[model samples]
Target: MANPNVKIWFFGGVNEIGGTKILIEDLGYDVCVFLDFGKSFSVEKQYYSYPNIPRSLDELIRINATPDASKMPVLQGLYTQSEITKLSQQKLLELEKSNQFKEEQESNIDAIVISHAHSDHYQYISLINRNIPIHISECGYNILKIRKWIERPSLTNNLFLLNVHTFKTGQSIHVGSLKIEPVHVDHSIPASYGFIIHTSGGTVVYTGDFRFHGHNPFLTYQFHDKILENEPIDVLLTEATHVTKSILSNEDEIGRKLQQAISATERLVIADFSDTDFDRFRSYYNTAKELGRSLVVTLRQSLILGALNICEGLATPNILKDETIKILIPKREDPTKPVTGERLSSWQKIYYQHLGAEVKGSVQSEDLWMPFKEMLAKMGTPPEEKLISHAQMLNKSREYVLCPSFNTIGDLQQVKPAAGSVYILSTSEPFDEEREIQFEKLLNWLELYGIPMLHVHVSGHVHP
Candidate 1:
């Protein structure tokens, strides 16, 4: 027999920013595994934008979720039985079936090792076969669990039932013929990791997504010394997200600019940024506390911050315990009726209870804003500091920093910020025409509200 050979095929994340899927097969052991089988954000617009999706595996393959696995016999179990039936009906099932096909195999994959919990890197995990053992860091898995709760539409409780094999950093996981060692790497999101694989053929190092100037550059250095420098690598796969251009600023520099903007503005300052970025969250949280103002956050953001605070190594501030942290429970946007617990879904109810937020008829009503105003009063501001109207917020523009996103632009219209108040654009700018249209619309909204928009952003990716 020929010497054992290793064949590597990439199903995604080739020439794009995300949607990475790497398949490795050790012919000697007749076993195969995957590294970061994630969905791509780029190809999505080619098919569906929102509220539209492929109903079955055949449709998904046509749109490119599991593109290469369709023809591979060994990976047939990755799809659900009903999905396989649909594939068979379409004559798209090319895998040779054995007599024992009546019983689904234990797994289509020997194992799956995930790099991080970013949707682009791990969104399609639900499509994987149920029996396959998923190996990920404890921190990464916890992030996924929190996401399942916060982002109810993307995933469900079914994810919690998967065969998860949690590991720690620097620990090795042994599958049939592959030994995968997860190495810690820093990224915009927490619990991101890279991998060092030992195969019969040679050693392989896969950098999922990394940056050196994050909250911890030392973690990236640890990865370099422990895996890259020590191991003799035959195949090295790295991400070049920022290879074409230089990074604008490190995390600290971005924080400094943000502090300046916050200090100069004396009104209700609103900063729009990526919620998954905990480092940014820290910076804003600290600035809000330092300036003696409560940082107002949305329900989803509060949950994410609460989760990260409990999670180890992140060093996040406990929003629940901190008097400076205030949860801004926006009124449910149904113009036809008053917002109440009866109108909320089960998840929304649980989320509200978790935050210990008081329910009122509407967030726009004085009753809803009274609690925060009370807190402000106790902080030495007078009862006259209460925000009753957009005019009031404008007059007291120096009191708070409201964190909002593009999707919640409707709320801004309700708040009707004063003319001098600033809108800090802390997230990435439009990279595509579709996003550019949205950006133009956002500017129009701010212009209509008479608020000046300021651009101060930092890239999520590292400078290569």
Candidate 2:
């Protein structure tokens, strides 16, 4: 007989980027633990199929984020090629038929632990019968629930959701013979988690999506070392999101590069990165201040920042107005909106006075701050608007830090750098050849300008 306690199965994310199916056979209990079931949208869906988005309707049941068919160019479900979308429902059926995922009879399966709220990681969990106990960080749980605001409720809701459970950082519980500890880490999202599985084979770790830049990267190292010191080491699973050559660097290095670029560019120096990552947001602001530029985002970004502060036991990062560091958001659409530009700028005026840099060409200072001042100035703009920005530092045009930015490979190809700009890709390459075709298209564009590109990211999952 096979070793009763051995957890054996194909590690999905190992060979490719999606379908993270891990099987844990505990004394023949046959519990399969799934990490993620997301697909990288193909270039065809994102770029080529523009103006007319064709979502695989069958896939809607398997994933959330319902697209308004009435609305043109609305993309729901994780990004995938048109072809992939076609096969998604079929593939899921195959997996289920082959006993790759949970079935109704195996109620003894302990629980499903979701790391953060990324669709690639958690949306499929919704498709899984809600009856299986669901474990996740509070941040992820709320984000997942908030989908009602963007998509249909029933499209996401399932019967199994009734038993959902939330876990806080450093919390642990025993499920069957396995003890799982939810450890917190830094990611684009606020509450990403890594898990520690205690078993007879030894202690195993599954760090979902993590970075070392935030307040506690070293702390994560400590947790891993401490656990490894006491328990027998068997398998250490982590994401190699940044395993490419010198293409990817740790976030700290990225921060330093950002500072240099801001200082070098004498223009407006618009820096575009993730608004969700508190650390990145702070880093960008700090770099701007150091280089005599001000920081700014839309009103939506400001509100989200405030929300993040309330959830984590941390103070809102300060913006210096007088000292020259300023955070600006566009004006609110309606008069009754919660936060707006005028009110933010008036406060910013105080910081502007303090920094003295507000006086144009003055030396940069610290303390004086402003929030959303520019937005207040744009209050009277017309209803019709267009998306066009020539800033050298904008992120790859993503509305949110966690979701797919472009819909297809063709969409990515259209992005071109003017003579002297940089494109920093912070994740892994497409796992399949068909997906890589888009990469080829993107590379062709980069070659035109001899633009130097780098994959400045770190791993989110562990290697075999």
Candidate 3:
């Protein structure tokens, strides 16, 4: 039997989207360091502002609210990950009672080095307390700061303890016995990192969720260079997101293909995508403009435009200020029930307001949305089509905002759009193997709605 402290276990996010927990133990030093603590999602775990709000792909996971015995099918063997997520969830609920979470972290962990700011990567880290300092990239730190601004400020008070240490792309930082080197690599998002961990025994290069589409060869070269520069690495913890031969198209090629596909469509193309994924999202926006049609986006996505100040996001001034561009906000009046949430603004509010579409129902203006309830709130059944028409929906389909890829299963917004027609998927390869399978699930849904062209998209991540 190997020593307990010498083992390295990937508790979550091995092949799935969430519950990414990795533990490294060194019995010789009586130490164990937790790599990442992220939770996965299930359609059942989705949160809704109102039942009517459309569902998103992120909503598909069973949010780990508590550490429990239940196991994720993909992550069944990783018992340690499951327990941690469950416990983390429980602690979050009781977080109101005490500041003990900070003190409890030292139980086994020496440090946490975050790779990026994707929900699966850093949301769980946000769950950790003030005392534990986290090592991260500069971009990751900016993203976390923005995330705090986006999520509730009160619930995550100690989040300021999110001591984010920004390391350069090639810089290496040492923590006790663990020496970690951060390498800048291309993922769908910029500043995403793949780390090389050096320990007494050997080294391991963990690819924290990456895609090598067009500039991928750069990673291969870097990999070989690192091997030559350092001693031999014992393990290469890589993400098999597109391990299959299917991930062949590079970002440019996929973008071109998506362009061709969009060209084939007549009406304004409305796509539902993660606003955070500015590259692909902006690509679509650019494509729409290139075709001489106005590409309409929602306030949520357009919000990304001003955030360029945060870092290297994809929103451009011309594109951000486009006239044909329309932004969606909650109806000024309670088009439905009342709403409640604070508004986020510094420049985006003015930016969106200038573009002419800031009704309500967004990360910002959520609180103002409450007045919309009384102002534009639908008292009984929705108003006649004429009244709804006043809301400025798509005119024959040219406008597009990339949205969730799946159906509500049984949630709100009864229109459902049958599945396929409403959501515009990119031609990019599936995010990971599990994502490939999950994409199949969404495809099945599109089959229900008979939404044509399910795989009509491109990848923002690069490859060599």
Q: Residues 89-124, candidate 2, lDDT per residue (tens digit)?
A: 224334333443433333433566777776555654
Worst 10 residues of 3 by lDDT: 379-388
Best by TM-score: 1
lDDT (Cα, tens digit) per residue for candidate 3, span 1-464: 13333568665666555556676665555545556655444322344233333232222233433232234322222222212233332233344234343443332355677776666665556445444567877656655544443333332122434446678666787777677887766666656777787766677677776665543447545755676687676777666544553545665665676677677665434365555565565566667667765555444444443343345433253334345454444444332432222453423343333433333444333343232222122111121211111134443444443333223222113334432344455545454455577567766765676566535543533323
Superposed Cα deviation of residue 246, candidate 3 (Å): 2.5
32-124 in candidate 1: lDDT tens per residue? 888987877778767766577546656667877566465887676765443333232112112221212232555557878888877777777
Q: Locate the minimum summed-lDDT window of 10 residues in model 1.
A: 89-98
Assess each prediction's global lDDT (C-alpha) against the native.
Answer: 0.67, 0.46, 0.49
- The full ranking of all candidates by TM-score, starting with the best, is 1, 3, 2
Q: CA RMSD for every model?
A: 8.6, 13.3, 9.8
Q: Where is model 3 more than 4 Å wrong at Cα? A: 1-6, 15-17, 27-31, 42-107, 152-161, 214-224, 304-309, 312-326, 332-423, 427-451, 458-464
Error of 2 at 362 (Å): 46
Residue 453 shift from truth in candidate 3, angstroms: 4.0
Per-residue lDDT, model 3, residue 288, is 68
